[model samples]
Target: MVRWWRRPWIVPFAAIVVIFLAFSIPPYLSFDPARSRVPQPPSLGVAHFWLLVPHVLFGSVALGTAVLQIWPRFRRRHPAAHRRIGRVYVFGGVLPAGLCALTIGAYTPYGPSTRASDVVLALLWLGVTAAGWRAARHCRFGEHRRWMIRSFALTASIITNRIWAAVFVIALSPQLDTTFHGDEGLLSWVASSAAAWLGWTLPLLAAQWWLERDHLRTRRVHSRPSASPTPEPALPHP
Candidate 1:
């Protein structure tokens, strides 16, 4: 059986889909403020609006660079490029976006659950990315890889949240549209809260699982007997 990673096309395909969604959605699709609730805080003031733009732009950059960074081939073939992009992912993308998340999440017009989730997500993203960088500095590549995977998982939350929202809307349209009306009611709050928490958390969990599996596979390979036992020299003498 072909290993999942050895499929050759899956990673690039997924990366393209992720990058496309991350880059394209914001520019092309217009979100209704009330329904989406993302623009509500920014709509209140110019400062908030400015904050929102950098948060989104840098977050997208982080997400894009992060997708590239995870490619083993890229990291192996272009180590310097990987480090440079990693820098951009952290400083340019993750840090600024995290700060933005903190600012907007606290003051969002959305309910308390969303605010709290946003804050948690932001802090985790920042912390994990920073941890990954520190690990790399210390030459702890394994630790760095794990933490970076975690950070990317959180970064991918921006994409996951949208996916969750789309799924919810499509799957539960009648109930969501009628009872909740998209963030205007209790059900809406519940849905938003669930999405907010699950988006990053689920991805993080999956990343950890993948990392652990990879680690175990590596250990198993290394631990395997490297050579066969030699045959007794002279059974004929016996």
Candidate 2:
């Protein structure tokens, strides 16, 4: 059986992430006040837009680099390149985007649930990446790899969040008038917040399950008793 890490789906998964990032990020680049996705705080005014730009741009950088970072073939063939891209993913992509997410999440018009989820997600992303970097610096490569798998899981959760949000909205549409009282705005926040909770949390749980599966397999191998050495037969020449 093929190893899970070497499965054919990994590359295709990364490509889909890149494609989604491309489709989602362009509207922010227009820089028109009318097009801002983030709700600017009354005091912050246009400052939110400034933050959103780098957040999206660096996020794209991080998302793109993370694809390379996670590619087993890339790491095996170009260790130095992998290290360089890791730096970019950390310093450029996740660092800025995670920071901006802290503020943006709090300001989300959706509801408290979404705000809560986003803040928590941002914190975990940064914390996981930091742990991964520390592990690498200390030469604990195994631990580093595990932590980075987690960080990428968090990084990719945004894509999942978008998908969940759309799914919830569509699924709830039938109740727009009967249940939501025909308040489109009300339904929007309800779905958005619900999606926010499921998106990152579910993916992170799956990542943990994946990591534990590998760890358990390793332990199982090590726990097996070694075969006893057999005595050699007396030489016929004797």
Candidate 3:
């Protein structure tokens, strides 16, 4: 009965989410080879670009579905519609996106640090989503909600990933001459790698913290014993 979605920030939060997705998804929608974030050319070719495209597109599906899924009124009023959206989120979104991410992460042109972080993120995303789906399948609504919220946190971390990347690039770029021996490339790589780890990890940790505190508080309240009728004294004298 904990209604985490009934928050005062819902309107502003939705507005921010709309803007975030606008920034996140437009470049990839054109499908122009040049617009791809992954480097192209004789160096890497169009194959990785293709992979990046599907990953972004499918992830967009997941993100869109997550926005709908978290809408408490819609979910409460239309259970069937909510279930259908959840299905698309799992099948059309997470599965394809996660596979592409796993592939791209495995053979990224980036350094070991970025590769490791991305690979682990993909695996955890896939695993956590699957767990949520399983919980729903078993009709464990409470567990399902928690698991799905965790999944959404990971999905939405794509925004944080870009935000952190920009932050690191700005902060570290200035240090190129002093710390990186004027190596702009090294500074960029370091920034990217660090962002890859902190972006998802920090957000996911925050989500877990929020969920854990609620769960702990509820559990403690439930664990307290209820008052009972006084027991009849045994007829020891008889």
Q: Please give each candidate's TM-score.
A: 0.81, 0.91, 0.87
- Candidate 1, 1-238: lDDT as tens digits: 3455785865875767576655654742343233333555544554555556677777778877876787777778899999899999989989998998888878665579988999988898889889999999999998998899899889878778877766764655567657766634566566677778888889999998999899999999999987988977876655
Off by over 4 Å in 1: 1-37, 42-44, 176-183, 231-238
Residue-level lDDT of model 3, residues 1-238, one tens digit each, is: 4454556566665676788878767878898878876665344578778888899889988988888798887798899999999999999999999999998887777678988999999999999999999999999999999888889889988888888999998888778889999987688779889889998999899999999999999999999999998999988875
Question: Global CA lDDT of candidate 1, please?
Answer: 0.77
* Model 2 pairs in collision: none
Q: How many backbone clashes does candidate 2 have?
A: 0
How many steric overlaps are in each model, in order? 0, 0, 0
The lDDT leader among the candidates is: 2
Which candidate's TM-score is highest? Answer: 2
- Quote model 2's TM-score: 0.91
Least lDDT summed over 10 consecutive residues: which range in candidate 1? 28-37
Q: Candidate 2's residue-wise lDDT over 70-139, tens digit each?
A: 8787788899999999999999889889999898777766778888998999999999999999999999
Provide the lowest-lDDT 10-residue window in model 2.
1-10
lDDT assessment of candidate 3: 0.86
The C-alpha RMSD in Å for every predicted model, in order, reads 4.3, 2.6, 3.5
